[model samples]
Target: MRYFLPSKRLGFLLLALLLCGFALNFFMQAASLNMDAMSVFSWIGEYYWLYLAGGLFFFFLLLVFSMILPSVYAGSAVAAVLCIVLGIVDYKKLSTTGEPLFPWDLMLLKNAGEMSHITKGMIPPLALAAAVLLIAAVVWLLFKLPKIKVSLPLRMLFAALSVAMITGFVSMVAHQSSLAVSMKYQNIFWNQKVNYKQNGLLFAFAGNLRQSLIEEPEGYSRRAIEEIAAKYSKLPDPVPNVQATQQPNILFMMDEAFFDPTRLPGLSFSEDPLKFIHEEESATPSGFLLSPEFGGNTANIEFEALTGMSMYFLNDGSIPYQQKIVKMSSLPSIVSILKERGYRALALHPYDETFYNRNRVYPILGFDAFTSEKDLDNAGRITPEGYISDKAAVQEALRELKASSDPAFLHLVTMQNHFPFTKGHNGPNTISVEGTSPSYKDELETYTQNTKLTDEALAYLQQELLTLDRPTIAVFWGDHLPALSAGIYTDAGWDSEPRLKHETKLVMLANFNIGKEPLNTLSPAFLGPTVFRLSGQPMPPYYKLLGKVQDEMPGLSKQVLIGSNGALTAFTPEQQQLLDDYRMVEYDLLEGENYSQDLLF
Candidate 1:
């Protein structure tokens, strides 16, 4: 035996395979809520065969990569490293934002500036241990693992076989409902957290693979959409606004990670952090916008506000910007409505234009001009985290508004108050928490001041609107709340349940009286029509239909629907009919053959 194979290569390979399999599980759990180690072990033990499937799936991927590369060692290392990096990124995301980074989320790596915060304190104990063991194996592979020479023909054949195997296995896992069912898989669209927990990381990812393939709504047909369009076109305007002297220069600001920190049960500050916005809320038509996303994922809310559509109707966690927006010829939006009325539609964001595929998506959405960080004169004025200040963002936005005398439809997505609420980022703490640990103070301090800066930014914007002498209405609201600590919401005695985590403040103020009908808590989808109505501009048939939806269901999302009475209620028969109508229009416009485009937009 010593003469034949002294190196014991078979034993080494087996050991390495076992280590890789176990690492995948660790990474999956780390990517989730750092799920308790004992619980994870118990689950693995209970479903050992299913866990084996995950390992084998990952092994197949490695085999494919190994065959493709010049050397098996190099290829396997590359594949393994990629998996570990993704695991770390997901771990960071779940740690801060309480959501695992999905496979589609890999597209976000191009905008690595926003991901820097994830690099800090991202590795947990399990990941660290896994890394230590994996590194040693990697070192052995580099130095000691012998490369067995095979013929070129044999190598090519193996590569092709490996590719075929991987394709077939993944396709089976993604498409076969029965296979997934047998292994206890499910589609928890409304709550991915629960989905991830129920099915471990690999299966959850495989589940998303199936979900990513867009599905046509039941009874979807061109004729059905056309009929739905015609019905809504005939309804009376749901949100008829007070007539303005002229169409108001609608200045919409979707502030990033903005919310009242004081709203936390035990939080307080030396003075009000959101003083200006607080005053504006009381004076103007203000309420909450039950956002479709929590922590972060601004594009979803942005999409809803621009186009009178809800994410509720689409697959969960689907980014229309990344997934669908660019594929369509044109989608009707507030920009489309305003542009037709001789307004120069501008989208200004104080961040990378490519961050959310905005550079590509904005033009298609009917923006005359899309300005981002690179285009701004004050792009360099950034916070410690490199997010552009709201001060600079507002200045650039005002400059643009003044430049174009045409009735302007300006939308600015500010970044000053974005996440990674690191301690001492603001130099000194302005906010205090009564029951929070000392560990939580730094993030709170940064978050509160960042919010305060947003208030100051609002003041600047409002003052500029007054000086313009144009009938201007501004809708300022948080894109979503900051992803603070994991148990922060629960620790505080606030009534913010998981569903309410999606709630963010909405304030619509103007240099003129925009409205006074108490535009209480509504979804962002309704904001477009609300603003259009405020400007006294007639909405297209699509918006008219949306206005009706708003009348019936003021706040709508897959998570919760706020009935007209301003409380969560099961859909009435009338409400269900309205929703069916809304869904047909949205699907027709976004994914379906645009049979209703002629009649709706």
Candidate 2:
């Protein structure tokens, strides 16, 4: 009759505690607009066992801890309750607006200004009641257990061990998918729905398990994984030869909200942002990049630029950063290639490394060093919009460049001009568009200001390199076009598909040495070969495979512009075959299929 034994009372008490934990966690999740059961359930089917284990373990751990360290348990319980209550308050605002929440959206809770004004103050009491009930259940079970049957030390040890095992298991799955379900099922709404359905427990449990392994269409993918790995395998060949000669220092820059200056109304510049970067520095450039995404996905650009793989090849609407369904090479592989050739490779982003899972993916890609917001000591200098100034990034680059003994390959991504164009937003760095064309003023202003800042930084950098004893190469290009507001889209006669037009862009750029020649234009897709040529590395078979086509019909070689022309239309057949071939090869490689026939081509 001991409560600690496998009795009905013990099971009921454990279930009560689990339900309370689930409700609290659910409310926290449902507080954001980007979250909901659907987003949470996306991972449930893939890792249900882990979720169940976490609940059981956490319950036992807390129980043991409460006995051993009552004060600590009291503080933790208070904090947990507060977090849940705050989440409830936030959810009240969004629920009113009919906006849903996602599991990984707790970051949005910190955005104080976006919170809804309505103060219904409804759910806190109910949440408190549930918490009280759980506490009561636990207390009742303790009292019911016979003191002689269960040793205090044994009870405590069992709880602690369960907690430790559960915590470790949950941590492993959180990165995979079970974290989503654990958060959602914690909510009363989702739990109620599962209970209402026939065989709801089995169905919900299976769904949760499915989520952990499945690819995240909106966040990350297996195809992207393989693509990244493949890009690394094809890293600029002739490593030793490239290292023998005094190779120029390489600088990779990604400018925010950048588009073809050729598309801009006024293109004159006293100081060119990327005038010197060119092919004679040994160049290979593509026509149209045909990026699979636009507006918000800077990760796709990173994936493409580093992996030399196209997002267009994967399932549409998949995000490669969040999920790891496929394994692929990354910029780090290029870093490794350079490392072999006595070069130092580094990744620089003027933002939080955690934003796009850069912290997780950067090392896998092969970079020796990563510099992010944490690396910047002066946090105040960073923009209010959660981004460090590109100028700061350049400063750090200069410092890092001076310290490195070997030729360096640096990846620098800038974020100054990211959309929402409003004057006075970024302090002294703001570009004034008051006198410019009123129609495109807001949109143009942000780009002009950000571009101007980037230009100034580059001009200073060029001068800095002049002081450097060794030769250097700086490659700079726009990540994507500016994100125009809805007003401009509507005003500019965009009725049917405004999102598509805004997405269209020119992504090719100058691949110049300190003072080298420049190509008239090229596509972003051609960058891999272009990098190989610039670095004096051997082109793999595929680069040559596409290189001949570019040579024969240079006009037809643009990466993304094949939709309009007759010859281009005819070439689609060949392109599709190439895509299929590449896809199968990529998949096979991910599946660990070893091939004697090199697929490097």
Candidate 3:
């Protein structure tokens, strides 16, 4: 007992072993969903030296802290507790969002109130009990250990060295050193889920932190902006001047977590929930929309749709509504153009107005009024779920359209079916799921039933619009797929194809008849131009350029772009130049001097 008690050599060795074990434990927790316990050995086999260095550095830092503390176990236990908490957080984040925790997410801790819906039932009771016991044991061991002491000057020197070592390690990783080549591939911005799965959560989080700052696009300058504007400044063919021509009222409804679950292979429901959607598709322009997001990130899809910008060009996990639109006088949005052409642009979202900073962002997007849940409640439009339903939202929109004599452009985002479809949320389960695990039946039923409600509301809105004296165009699309549990997709056998996973339904219906040509496929960025074209409104030069790109490539996303040849190929020089010009103009409108405002709006 005396030989090991308070001895620097023994204490340091034990601390080092503890740190290595803790790191391995964290890795196992982060990889639990995808990899077996034995996979830790494989990770160590690939990056043994890196893991060793990290363990040793952490051990050294803890040792230095122990010198200042009453007992070596106290410092080591503190480190253990912190690592355990981080591991738990990483596990929960991965389970919920299908991506590891990025450092940027920490800034959203204040929005914890809004996360209860998604985070419910994430951590099981047994895991919580085990964590409690583990923490208590660590505290007991910390107090039971003997105390150690060192001089003040030595402790300070040790602390400084530890900080320097950590700083050096972070710098090396940030610069993409050969030592971090394995991590480089995992830090890519295109797909965070794959990145988190390939690399462990800690490495992926560090990589994301290093790349959090937005990078300026190449050839971003006043001169370049001028040249691009001059080059592609040709206006789209104007609508013919005739007495029959009239500006159609436009309504865009972005439904939350609304997808066609029937697309899942080997999955069947008792009844077809999207019967109305099918009927509408048969009569109007409708097809699959290739969304930039999967499962979540609604604001990104909205950004792409409104401003004609692809999230592929931005940093991963970047929230333009929260980060980029700060203090901008004007942004490139279809709303701005509509407002300029004798239309009253209104933004309606029946949820927390401040969720995505939409209250401020809507004004910058050229909306005359921003109506949210508060306004909905004041206007006596509340649903049973406490969220305003699609029916209520459309009813309010109809009122606005009727009250205003001028043509109105309303962007309505519905929140009736926003996630955590657990049980009893959507009332009784009318739809039955087959070929899926019994566990997901309730969830699937809830989702399907809510979508049915949305479909009914859409059909009602269309009918009401048809009765109106003025012509109206209604565009409806799902923001992204629902964040269903992994078991649902895995058991349904639809987990292999990412393209299929990201596909969602889109439909454009009009009171006055339009061409029956199918929309085929398009990214959210091209929806604005599509809307303009369908309404017989002339598009700006930027939108015209996007129209030309759409002519060559119908669907463009980070993962794939379908070209005119109906084949997926790397971007040609022409496509790259076109995208570059688009990026420059987008940057100019959002972050630069608004150099292309004349060309855009």
User: What's the residue-level lDDT of 235 in candidate 3?
Assistant: 51
The digit string of per-residue lDDT tens for model 3 on 481-569 reads 88888878776666776667677889988887766668877788988888777777776778887787787777787765777776466
What's the lDDT for residue 120 in model 3?
60
lDDT of 2 by residue, 252-369 (tens): 7776766543333333433333343221223323233333444555776776566554454443323455444223443323455566678788998866677557776777677889
Return the TM-score for candidate 3, rounded to 2 decimals: 0.83
Which is the leading candidate under TM-score? 1
For model 2, where is the 10-residue window of minimal lDDT?
A: 194-203
For model 3, the stretches where C-alpha displacement exceeds 4 angstroms are 1-29, 32-35, 56-85, 92-98, 132-172, 175-200, 210-220, 238-246, 326-330, 378-386, 400-406, 467-470, 565-567, 570-577, 587-594
Give model 1's clash tally. Answer: 0
* Models sorted by TM-score, best on top: 1, 3, 2
Q: Give TM per candidate.
A: 0.90, 0.54, 0.83
Candidate scoring better on TM-score of 2 and 3:
3
Model 2 deviation from the true structure expressed as Cα RMSD, one decimal place: 11.3
Per-candidate Cα lDDT values, in order, are 0.75, 0.49, 0.73
